[model samples]
Target: MADLSVAFVGKKLRSPIGVASHAVLNEGLSGTEKETEQLKAYSDLGVGFVHTPFICPEEEHPKDAPPGWKFQGIRSREPFMMEGLLVATEARRIMCRLNAGLNMIENLKENLPDDVAVIANMIGPGADPDGWAEHCKSAEEAGADIIEMNVSCPLPASEAKAVQEYSTGEMSEAAGSLLGDSLQLLLPVVKAVVEECSIPVGVKLTPETGFPRIIGFAEGIRNAGAKFISGINAPITVSPPDIYKNGQGKWPGMTTNPICAALGPWDRFLLYRNLGTISLFVPEIELAGIGGLVEPEHVVEAMMLGARVCEFSSGILWKGTDIIKESLEFLETYMDRQGYNSIEEIIGKGVKYIVPVEQVDWRQEDFIATVDDRLCTRCGRCANNICKARTLEENPLRIVIDSRYCIGCGLCQAICPEHAVSIVEQKHPVIGISVDE
Candidate 1:
């Protein structure tokens, strides 16, 4: 049998399958009692550390707007619907909506079982490192075992915008302009929190920045005496279509807003890349991989790629909390079957499998797309959506194959709503992969 027990945030966890900070545990203010009960249930089920919200003293709505200013907060007007529900009074609900840290911690102490380790997640602009550090001390006093500094939220809410300047790429330049490049702003508070608290501190990051920048940032945190890293939060931006219909007939279709903070399949790949890069610098640092973990295979894959722990959230939105227990069961079975005795033994086993650029073939040759007209609805959905080659046509409701323009990338086939498109080998002259060798 594999030993799933491992240490994280200065405490030993029963398993690596831990819940990501989410509304489920916080449950707004209205259902604080129920949410605390739920946390206890998760602890009994043998979960690792339980993460809470990116805590701040208060939640303020953005006042001055930028050109594309969208509301950024736990409750945003974005179309990505979260599936959990809460039962709470209007006032308590509003309080929970405002100061997540105060309310969530108070509830955890009042209700959660003593054995369950609580990880308080803090978020704000890096400019307010002292304030964040003070908040960390407060959380530690409130029985928090660890503090997770959130620096990677994608949505530009007031807090996110405040810290946006410190992010990678253009965002970092913006941040430097606002606050100089010393990276000293975060140091004072980080050092203060580490000195004040008995627990370990970890920083969460995103993959949007280049590797060198991430390494530099991590090195800075490590220099400040932080203990671990948890990151690559929701790397890709997904623009899911609006499916709701209003009373005014078909609702006007607004362009799909990039998923503010949600994670999906695309994010998983980015997390893998980021993990690979981080391993190059701090091979021994504990890493908690977050975003887009949907199945047991995703957990195992992340572990193999050098993650010491995996944080999950979105899968529960798509499936349910039951998925947590099911995933753990699956992982335990997998570990047994693989003949591994512990989670650490399998860590980084899959990193070597990541193929370098030299192993990839960039040369393109030939392939063909064949549409089964029988399944064709000719809704023009596929043709209009992604047919960059413009080879697809409409009317009698059939896609006319233009071999000259088609590169056979299968974009049209993939977007076809009717399952009418297929890419098959061309019987004529082989042009691409078939022609080579």
Candidate 2:
């Protein structure tokens, strides 16, 4: 039998899937009763854990601005993309929700057959370390098994002190990614929480840190004493405006351009960038995969890269809570079929093949691309796109390969819309100049 149980951040989880802290969990305005039911529903569905909504120390901020949500469903055949932005207020996280979340945590802990860990999603209290520590402590007191510092939220800062902190890079005074990206500002907060909390501490990272820089960002937070890392939070982005009207296209009516949080499948590669990098470079940091996980297979992919646990936000919003059961079914079946006894066996399996550009030895000569004339629709897509190695023949009016420049990269084979291209073994792998074959 496949054993799906694994230790995440030192806490035992029956399954690696969990509900992420997202907008829908904000039950303060809608009322906590609904949110509690949502938590119970997830626990009942076979999820190993449940993360509470983002709750701040202060219920209301002195400076408050509502970050609105905007979504655009791109029309295409590519993997589904629902690009969006969230310009919402973290300041509005009310005490009512926090109280409700606390109750849900306690109730779920007492009732569930197998203990379902409740992770509290908390925002920083700006520059106040004591206040921030107390906020995390509050979650711990509320029966949270883990406290996740939500430093990576996509919303901007809204308070005077937070705005001043944002001025360093013109970031949001809102304490999400604005605070998470700041090494100086965020480190102190992480240290405070780690020192203050007896429970496991984790930091949710921002995708906006950009690549290369993310390497240092993860290391810094780990050094600050965060027990684990869960990412990637939504990216801060601008919606493309309609050129005709010179205004951004959104619901209700076209409004002036505003920076908003971008979420969905497009962020998958970005998730790998951080998870893989941390797994490869910062081997000690336990990672939780978050972004771009719409389907069940993505959970396997993240674990392959080195994530102990995984969660999905926009996908669950689109697909509903059923994604949890579907994901669990897929993971268990995958484990059994792959002949793995435990989830730990698969984590970081793919990291061995991941190499830096300098270490990559491009095998250039074993093969060359061939055009299958029968399958060829003679679609100009490959010829036009792959100028690097393919050329349109003048006399034969057929596509031919320039082996000298090809390097057998297979771009032409991949770009062919008609599936007419394939790479075949070369009898003699010669030094390339140009063969008009």
Candidate 3:
């Protein structure tokens, strides 16, 4: 049998698969004995590490409802929101009671088998750097093997100190937020925690504009003493939906007030993109590729793209605990079929396949786009969403393509709600210099 074991965050994981931190382990909010038992089950299933939530003691929690929750005004009145707070608080209390000093590292070391590593995930505003630093110390003292600094949450309190701005489609803002002045603002917080904690430190980052920004963040984190990097949290976010209706007035859900973002299928491509970039720049630090990983194929693909570890959250939510065993079995089979005995051999092999533009076959020219006008209500939603040329006119129940500005990127074709857009080869000037030039 091939040895699937791999080193991550300064320890060897029997397998690269691990459970990601989410609502499941927030024992205070979802505090059911069943959940802690589930975590032990995951460890038994060969999970490399199990990450616990950011620890905030009851005292630190709002004296009334909670600081942010009280200020938001919904937690006191809404049962569901208050229930979430209760879970968070209770989970913290449980962790503190279980581990002396409320240290996650100690708790895992005491409760879990020796083979399974325990990681602590901590998030805080930049203004509360000292608070985050103290949390890291507590986790380390408790016996955590690794510390994961979460710097990309989209929630308001979490967002206040977020290292990177949530991407809102503008490439400049997205790129600048992760790399430019913002990184300078974030480095100190990360540095402080890493210095305070004895264990290896890793930073979780969101998918920004592209690879350059991703590379920039990885480099900065490493410079700040981060031992590893976890890439591409929750790409392709949507606007929060309205959760309440007051006659004609509508209100958003309490969680949606700050915007609750989660990862989904649209993020699969981003996982590969960010890891590919990191493989080239920060090859020494272990990389955890996350977001949109659902099946065994995703695990194999992530490894090929230079991810030493892959974090899973949504897959468990959609498929349940059994998916863990299924994913491991599939990975083993995939490794066997490829005649590879170890993951390191295959890591970054796919990166070599990503060729430069000039090397690509430009002569093939087999572009296909089919637009269905039947679904096209002519609401101009597709045109408004993509068409920069303003060639799409309303009222005639049809879309007219302006061949000049359409670079054949197919933005209009893909965004069409009514399926009324199709791409046919029209002679258009090839713009700018090729990579060969």
Candidate 4:
């Protein structure tokens, strides 16, 4: 049997699956009672660890705040077509929406299983060392096993400031992505928090950095003494306006378009991008996956991309803690079938295959897509949305393979509903793999 246990930043986790920090309108304010209950529920469900909702400097947000979590699945007639959800709330939900994070951390430590660790997702006031250091110390004192600085949240309190400097090419020194994107500002705080806490410190990075630069951000965090990098909080987006409400944004009662965060399933790819890049470039720092993860399979995808731990937020909101159970059960069976002995064996296994676009050596002469006339129903389903390769023959009323037009990209084979299209070895160099080894 393969062991699922994984070591993250010096802490041994029972499994790599855990819950990401997110708002729970109930206990985020009053105290750690409800938050503890949720943590215990996760522990009972067999999660390896839990990240408490963001705790911030007391001045981050008001205690009695508006309802923060409002999310719903979005899918159109085209299923799986960029399927994802939009997340919005008051600008500040940090420190569990008013500095209740420490209490929650303490209570969680008391109620959760001793082996089930708690990660404090604390945010500070900009890049203030004293304040950020204090938050880290408090969480460590409260028995947190890890300290996760909330530098990358899309909807940080300083959102208004972020929007302005984004266009000016100067970032504001405020909480959230603004601080995460500004390496000049965030490195000092990372050093402060890392120095203040006895527990491992991780910096959650924003997706705004846009690739190659993200590698630099991870390197900076590692140099600043941070132990881990959690890839992605969420991507910033503008809510679409409602056509019926005179172009006002749709939110049931609201009619104004607001910039919000995009969360849930689709963000998984973005999470992978960060995870893979950091794993490949910055091998020294540990990596965690925290976006677009919904299904049990997504956890494996993240792990393959070199995530030491993977968190569930929208998945737990949608499917409950049972996702944890389902994931563990699936992992045990998957590991056994795949002949894995431990999680370490597979971590970063995919990195060797993920070369940069320019480094790929194309093998174009291997195979070209062909149509099996016996299987072709002439439904024309394979002829849809083909950018370079759409081979359709109308002579005998059946789909035929035109090698001249077909680049053998496999788009036709993938989209074929009738299973008529397939790629086969050809004499000439025609088929091109998406990533030629």
User: Each model's C-alpha lDDT?
Assistant: 0.60, 0.75, 0.60, 0.77
Model 3 over residues 1-437: C-alpha lDDT tens digits? Answer: 77778877668778888888654444533232545566677888878777775444232422343222211111334223321111111222222222322443454577787657787765543334565677677777767788877665333313333333433221121121232225655677778888888889888776654667777777888888989877665532333334453222112223433322445455678777878778876777778877778777888788888888887876776678777889888878878887988977877788776656788755434432334555556666656756554344646556555434555566766666555666655433232211111
TM match of model 2 to true structure:
0.87
The candidate maximizing lDDT is 4
Per-model clash counts, in order, read: 5, 12, 17, 6
lDDT per residue for candidate 4 within 34-135, as digits (tens), equals 667877888887789998877765634565765455654566664246477787665554346434677777778877776688998887766677778986
TM-score of each: 0.65, 0.87, 0.66, 0.90
**Model 3 misplaced stretches (Cα beyond 4 Å):** 29-34, 57-59, 63-105, 125-130, 157-181, 208-211, 240-258, 356-437
Cα lDDT, model 4, residue 77: 64
Best first by TM-score, ranked = 4, 2, 3, 1
> lDDT by residue for model 2 over 1-437, one digit each (tens)?
68888899888888888888775645644346677677788888888887777776545433453433445554445433344323333445432345555666677667664557888888756655677898889888877899988888776543334556676644332367777878887888889989999999999998978888888988998898998999698886666666676565553344655555667787889999998888888998899999989999999999999999999788888889778889999988989998999999998899999999888876668777777766777666778965677777666567777877667778777777777777766665434222466
- The candidate maximizing TM-score is 4
lDDT string, candidate 1, 299-319, tens digits: 988888888888777666657
- For model 3, the local distance difference test gives 0.60
